[model samples]
Target: MLDKLRREFTLITFGLSGVVLLIALVMTFVSNVTMQNNVTLSLLNRGLEVGHALNPQMGSKDREGTVGADSMLTVSVDVTPSGIVLNKSESPVGLDEDALDEIVAKAVSGSETSGTNWARHLAWAKKSTVYGLRIAICDTYSRDVSLIRQGISGVIIFLMSLCALYAVSRALANRSIKPVSEAWDAQRRFISDASHELKTPLAVILANVQILQRSKDMSAEDMRWVGRTADEAEHMKGLVEDLLTLARADEAKAGSVGAAGPMVELDLSEIVDECALEFDAVAFERGCTISCETEPEVMVTGDKQQLERVMNTLVDNATKYAAKDSEVKLSARRDGKKAHVTVNNKGAVIDAEDLAHLFDRFYRTDKARSREETGGFGLGLAIAKSIVDAHGGKIWATSDAASGTTFHVTL
Candidate 1:
């Protein structure tokens, strides 16, 4: 239970963390782009300020003068052959070639000097005359710095959120499932205790009943009642035994030695054949025929009694549920290292929905028929599955509406 809870908690935490990280990454990317745009706008404004200041300094003879007060700016008054060249302080270059050209054009057009603080540029015309200005303007945000910041912050936040989510999810899962685990344990204990308590008295009652039934003085009617009582007691005994079997199987308990109990290594084909022969008598009484097809000398290592019980349970189920005079086909085959045993019967088709759960404990395909003919508590398949499972095997069932149902066991 704890393992299951922990697994689910881990999955939930990781799943949520993945989603959060993806969103954070996208948001960070957008924010980075926006920030870069803002930075570009700032650079443009400084350029325009330079251009504006240079505009007043431009002259026909000297060509240039100081634009700003700080060492960040230097105005070289140069009269070149074609024009006056004025360069502004170092500024971030525009992102693309087009933006670069636009910045230069803005400076040359005197837009930077006359424009707002958002943009800046250096302007040059002829050698005798040129002006520069710094202006503020609007443009798209730059992406570089914002993206890097967002990436770093997103990674940090995602890691922290994952840790927090995992811790909280684990705690929540434990709390949410604790009650179920407790109830399961309690139920298991109650069944174990109750089954234990009932065994001794049931043994005593069976002993006394048997002793009484053997007496010669009893009337025929009384004998019949005693016989019925014995049969009912045996049935009850079987039910309790099944309960114990399932309980042990579920709890993964080892089996104890007993007379008429399973213990042996034997040829599975022979066992299957014997089970089919034995069921032939009962099947005949029910107007059902039993037959088997098996590979020769297929062997297995397990409890003989339990294996017999498994086969009998399958045959009994087939005979009980199959239509009148329907054939119950028992088959066994060796495929490489494993053995497969299947019982296919012609009968009313099982519903597709029910097939998935047919092997569940106390599950019945036909509840009314189960009550009438077999008086079954729906434990035959469950017990068979338990026995097969104890022997490290598997069991499953399949049904088709046009055909019938086939139950298969692999060992």
Candidate 2:
């Protein structure tokens, strides 16, 4: 239980932190891309403004003062609408004539006033001027490289931050759950101690009541009172025994009581068959029948006595609640490495809300039903679930009007 709590805490914390970090990284990337586009377009516009005087042979110093040092790599062209280059400026990097023609052709044919040709690492803008169609192209290789580096760095940082958050969240979860863990331990200890303390007195009371009922001189009225006392004592004893079983299950789950019992390979099919036979008479008394269908040699590894208890509890419960003249079915099968057992009965459908909490301690679907009517304190399913969990298996139930109620166990 504590492990589950810790895992949930870590996941929620790490997940929320990851989302926030991802958003920040994405926003930063977008802002940088927007800023780079604006700067590139501004350089292209400046080059078009000075189209008439953009001499191909102009020195770097002269052009630097005119359109900034970064704009030295810009290519300005004066082209006609029919795709003829009228005049062009020299590229500092010495781009060939074919490349320059392709750049001019793409810029002139573009529908937008400004756009980027990402394949060639260039940004271009065109405007109709008195000279001709003026087109400006700027190198975007350096800007693209910067953005790529930023993206890689952001990904690395996000991953590293998630790792760090996992550690921090785990530590915080441990600290947060410390008090609750202590309280839970205390509760389990109380139940174990109280149940142990009650057992002897309950036994003494029952023994004395049995002796009183056997007295020869006792009147019928007094004998009736003694029988009532014995019945009530018996009921209390059953409750105490259930509380002790739960306490032991709790201790086993917490790993404080060592192993629940010795685990060994056992034939699950035989156990199912045995439980069906044991409950045959009980089901008959309730006007229900027991049916068993088990695959031969179906096996699992678990404590034999505990597994028997689980099967007995399930079969008994089914026999009690099954509709009159209906069948209580018990089946066992092996599927690869896992074994499956199911106890199904035709009876009134358990509501969805009640089905979900069926394994919770002391949870009954019919709250108005007395313990005498139900013949249980509602801990049988919870005990079965605990045993299954200890064996690293699963147990659950499903109910509907047509199918009635079915309890399933996979080991």
Candidate 3:
């Protein structure tokens, strides 16, 4: 249960954190692009300033002075349509005639536009008049590229922070569930203690009723009353025993802390067959029938008594609620590395919501009907689940209008 809590907390926290991180990443990318566009336009405008100086008809001169523009530009080469270098700007490091011709060929053959090649540390912008020479501005987008690198580093930092946050959330989740785990353990211990205290009195009462039943001279009315008392006592005994089973199962699950019982190999097929036969008479009395299709010698490792209780609980539950004149079937089969046992009964379909909680302790679908007609505390399936869990197995129930209700066990 603590592990389950930890996993649930981790999933929920990480899911929310993922959304937040995604939003942060998106916002960072948008802001980076905005910054890049602003800076690129600034650089391109500077190039346009220098080009306008050469051709007064191109556009109006820039309001921002070109004082520091030359330092930023390595070479502003002018090339003709036939790829002749007409002019080259004054710079400390200038492009060779070969490089200028190559760039001019590509620019003239391609669309007239501004572009940046961060890989080769170059930026180029072109302006052309119809049937005239093409003047191009070329430089490096060092500032814009630096901004992009910063964005990349921010993304890496976000991922690392997310991982660190996840680790912290898990640690907090463990601490948060510790009190709940303690309270749950205490509740189980109390139930086991209370059930033990009640057992002696229940046994004494049952023994006295049996003694009274043996009196030959008793009147019919007295006998009936004694029979009723015995019946009630037996019912109480069953409930107390179930509570004890659950308590011990808890202990067993808590690191095998001196469990009340141990598991051993048992023929599951034989167990199912015997249980079906044992309940056949009861089913007949209730206008129901029992049918079993058990695979012989199908074995499992489990406690014989607890497994028998599981069978008894399932069969008795089926006999009580199964539609009159309908049949209940028990079957055992081997499925891969495990064994499967199923009990099916024809009955009204259970609602999906109620079906989900059918195995929860004290959660009955029809409380009044179960109390008056079925006479159970709604712990049968819960006990069965605990037993199966202890045996490293699983148990669940499913129902539908077409197939009736079925309880399946995998061991």
Candidate 4:
């Protein structure tokens, strides 16, 4: 349970951190791109303001002075409405007539006042001036290179940050769960200690009740009261035993009790068949029947007694809840390295929500039903689950109206 808590904490923290970091990185990249485009467009507009007659080489003193180094790569052209280029600016970069014409045609026909020609690594702006139409185009090679470097660096940093966050989150999760872990351990120990302490007194009570029942002087009404005491004592004893079993199971899971029991290769098929036979009379008394379909020599390595208990618990649970005149099916089969056991019964369908907690200790779907009627404190399935878990197997149940309810065990 502590392990599960730690895992969930780490995942949730790391996932949220990763998302925030990703969003920050994306926003930074987009902001940089937008800023770069705005600067390029501003340079284009400035280039158009300074006509070709005012050459920077001539050191023309104008309102905007000589164009900056970035604007030096700009190409400005004045074109008539009839697609005639009347004036053009000199550019350091070579541009053939065909390429220049293409750039001019695209800029003049563009829907937007300003846009970029990505294939040519060019940013352009168009405007209607006193001299027909003015088109300004600027090279964006430097901007593209800067953005590319930024993107690669951002990705590398994002990945590194995630790795570091994962390590830190795991550390935090462990530290955060320490108190809960201590409390859980304390509870388990208390249950183990309390149950151990109660066993002797319960045994003595039952023994005394048996002795009193044999007394010859007891009246009929007094005997009835003694019998009731014995019955209640027995029920209390059963509950204590169940709690003790759960405590031991918890210890086994934590490796504090070493191995729960001896594990040996045993025939699961035989266990299933035997369990079905043992529950035959109980099922018959309930107007239900036990049916077994076990494959021969289905072998698995586990504690034989614990495995038998699992089978008995499943079969007994099925028989108790099975509809009148219905069959409780117990089956075992070998599938490669795994042995499969299933107990199915035709009964009222268990709700999806209740199915999830069926193996939880003292969890009963029929809350209003008397424990006397079920002859259980709802610990049977929990014990079965603990045993299966100790054996490194899986146990779960599925229910539906058409197929009724089925408990599946995979070992």
The candidate that achieves the highest lDDT relative to the unseen native structure: 4
Off by over 4 Å in 3: 52-64, 67-77, 81-85, 88-112, 116-123, 130-152, 216-219, 256-260, 294-299
In order of listing, the candidates' clash counts read: 38, 0, 0, 0
Residues 62-181, model 3: lDDT tens digits: 365433543345455566777676666555444566656656777778875766555555666677755344444445556656766878887888888789878987887878888998
lDDT, model 1, position 403 = 59
Which residues of candidate 1, in runs, are more than 4 Å off?
1-168, 253-271, 295-308, 333-339, 370-372, 389-393
For each candidate, what TM-score against the reference? Answer: 0.65, 0.93, 0.82, 0.86
What is the C-alpha lDDT profile of model 1 across 338-374, one tens digit per residue? Answer: 9899999998888888888787877876665644466
Residue 301 lDDT in model 4? 91
Error of 4 at 399 (Å): 2.5
Model 2's TM-score against the true structure: 0.93
Where does candidate 3 have its weakest 10-residue lDDT segment? 52-61
lDDT ranking from best candidate downward: 4, 2, 3, 1
Q: Is candidate 3 or candidate 4 better by lDDT?
A: 4
Off by over 4 Å in 4: 54-60, 63-66, 77-88, 93-120, 126-135, 210-224, 334-338
Residue 109 displacement (Å), model 4:
7.8
lDDT (10s digit) by residue, model 4, range 1-411: 888999999999999999999999999999999999888877788878875643545444557866566667677889986668999887674556776788778766766787776777777788887767888878888899999999999999999999999999999999999999899999999999999999999999999999999999999999999999999999999999889989999998777883348889899999999898898999999999999999999999999999998988998889989999999988999877899999999999999999999999989998998898888999999999998999999999999989889999999
CA-only RMSD, every prediction: 9.0, 2.5, 4.4, 3.2
lDDT of all predictions: 0.67, 0.87, 0.79, 0.88
- Give the C-alpha miss distance for residue 163 in model 3, angstroms: 3.3
lDDT string, candidate 2, 159-180, tens digits: 9998998899889989989998
Report clash pairs, candidate 3: none
Candidate 2 vs candidate 4: the lDDT winner is 4
